[model samples]
Each structure stands twice: as C-alpha cells, then as structure tokens.
Target: MYYKYPNGDEIYNVMAVYEAHEVYGIPRINDDEGLELRYFSLDEPIEELNPFTEYYLRKAGYINKW
Candidate 1:
C-alpha cells in the first residue's frame, strides 16, 4: 500500500491488513535502516500514526472517514 504524510510526502509498500483492529507490515526503507513488524489499530484512531495508517485504512476501505 501507499503511505502519505501530512507534509505531502509518501512511501509505498509499507503495509498490509489481515484482520480486525490490526495492521501488519514494515516500511521498505534502506537496508541499513533494518525492518520490524509494526502494528496499527482499526478499532480507534491512533494519535501517533504519522498520519499514514489512517490514510491507508481509509484508502483500503477499512474506514469511511476520520
């Protein structure tokens, strides 16, 4: 999926959804930056989303609006 920032930047292939209230994936940055499994909630808005998680949720049809 695509991740968008409030500053108008974007990153792609950074996420995937497999179940309710959770998202599973990692941002594909430089290999030196490494990777890890990150989580996001669909049950409620997250205050520290970097703004991208919500955008993904909405774009993927998991949410209608913020």
Candidate 2:
C-alpha cells in the first residue's frame, strides 16, 4: 500500500501481507479486482494493526521513535 502526505512531499510504499482471517474470518484470501486505497482522516482514531505491519513500517523509516 502507498501512503502519500497531503502536500505530496512525502510518500511511502509499504508492503503488507493480505490476511483474510484478520480482517475477515474467512480462511482464503480476498478476491478483488482493482487496487483499493484507503485514506484516514486526522480526526479519525487510529486502529491497532498487526505487529509485523508496524515493524516493517517502522523499519522502512515511515515512522519515527519518540
């Protein structure tokens, strides 16, 4: 998935695994046609994701330690 800042100055291409069971309780992968990109609003609360996803994003420099 690719996340681009509103200013277009920063962009991040993150590689994430498709987990069907995590999002949906199905055992098989999702069968979709086109690419789907989801954007979050600043007012929206952030949801907790899998540890692997967070690790990769952090390692890729998309996130910084405080």
**Index of the highest-TM-score prediction:** 1
**Residue by residue across 1-66, what tens digits does model 1's lDDT show?**
676999999987656567644434663556766565445555667666656667777878886645
Tell me the spans in candidate 2 whose CA falls farther than 4 Å from its real position. 1-37, 40-45
TM-score of each candidate structure, all chains considered together: 0.38, 0.33
What lDDT does each candidate get? Answer: 0.64, 0.51
Q: Count the backbone clashes (under 3 Å) in each candidate.
A: 0, 0
- Candidate 2 pairs with clashing backbones: none
Model 2 lDDT tens row, 1-66: 456678887666656543232253323435685464444322333376556666765577654642
